[model samples]
Target: MVLIIFFTSLAGNALMICLIHWDHRLHMPMYFLLSQLSLLDMLLISTMIPKMAADYLTGKKSTSFIGCGLQIFFFLTLGGGECFLLAAMSYDCYVAVCHPLKYSVLMSWPLCLRMTLGSWLLGAADGLMQAVATLTFPFCGRREIYHFFCEAPTVLHLACDNTSLFEYLMYICCVLMLLFRFALILTSYGLILATVLCMPSTDAHQKAIATCSSHLAVVSLHYGTVIFMYVRPKTYKTTNYDKAVSAFYSILTPHAEHPHLQSEE
Candidate 1:
């Protein structure tokens, strides 16, 4: 099941990227953002899935310190980028639906490129900060991480020193990354809904709803698991349940987002 999801997500995202690149019709701002999404999803899945599959197949569940750090860095980089990218996508939808006349002016190619670049930079910054901070802690005995990947929380849990202060700091960062972006998405869609309801044409309402629905679905899947994993109360720490939720977002969310690619196509 894991391998199947890995290959499917990889192929689907790669194909989406290719189609957008080669097909001129898909060269619009919306598809451009989508292609960036495909690229991010592809990179994100590749960061962890290959190593995870190899570990599962060979029964060797160990990674070097460097390998683990790289995993955490790339995981946070791509994951954080996706959060911002999803917010940008919602704003794109809002502009296209509510302010169609200014969409080209508002979401132009250069603006899209800037948005994409900003997402990558922000995500990389977060990843670098967290990776350095997380790794600086001295990991003591019984370093067997309970989760499948070197997720920051799982690894942080092994610190020999007091991490309560660091965990609080991390929680604040997570809130800013996850909740802030989610709130932007909701606000964008809220405006979209208001605009749609005011439209006299039923066709316009249907079209706007149809376009936004896929994005909402993808956002729900991605944010639900991540918020549960990172933002939920630390008191709710169950290793097994954490592993299950981690697998859900790591493997399943990308697959779920693939259908949106087809819908856009």
Candidate 2:
């Protein structure tokens, strides 16, 4: 099942990348960021799922300390990057709809590239901080992480020493990085709705609403799963349901952002 999920997601995202790269009409800022998003999702799922599937199939749960840290590092980095990227994408849509005159100038190639780079950098830095703080703590026993991947909360639960400080710090970072981006996304959509209401053209108004609505659906799935997985207390035992939720955002969202659909719409 895990292997099935991994390959399916991989194929879907690969197709998205191909479509985005090959289609000249999909060369706008929105699709450009989405292509980058597809790439990020590919990397994010590739990092964890292949190994996890292999381990599950072979019944070998063992992972080196360094390997575990690397898993957490990539997972959080991509996760945070996706959050910001989604928010950035929403902002792009808002600009395109609300400020059509300035849309091209504001979301130029250089600016889009910078936003992409900044999202990755910020996410990496945040992930690094969490990984360092997590791995530095001593683990006397209970090496088994409840989840398939090395999630921070689950990994922290395995530690021998006190983790209250680390847990609190991680929570703080989650609030800042994850919740902050979510708030910005919601605010952008709210402003977008307000702007769309004033537009007289029914066609333009409907299209604008459709775009934002699709974006909101994606955002809800991505952030909802994440908040459910990570925000709660560590002692909370992870269920198969939790794993399923994680897979949705980690795999499904990128598929939904496939370039073919973007171009058609």
Tell me how many clashing residue pairs each candidate has: 0, 0
RMSD of 2: 3.1
The TM-score of candidate 1 is 0.94
Q: Which prediction has the highest lDDT against the true structure?
A: 1
Badly placed stretches (over 4 Å) of model 1 are 254-265
Q: Write the per-residue lDDT of candidate 2 for residues 1-265, one digit (tens) a residue.
A: 6677778877877888898799898888888888888788789988887887788789987889899899889988988888888888988987877777777798898989889998899889978988889999888855676677887777777788988987887777787777888898888889988987887777777677677676678788888878877776666745676667666766555345522112111
- The lDDT of model 1 is 0.85
For all predicted structures, in order, the TM-scores are 0.94, 0.89
Off by over 4 Å in 2: 233-245, 251-254, 258-265
**Model 1, poorest ten-residue lDDT window?**
256-265
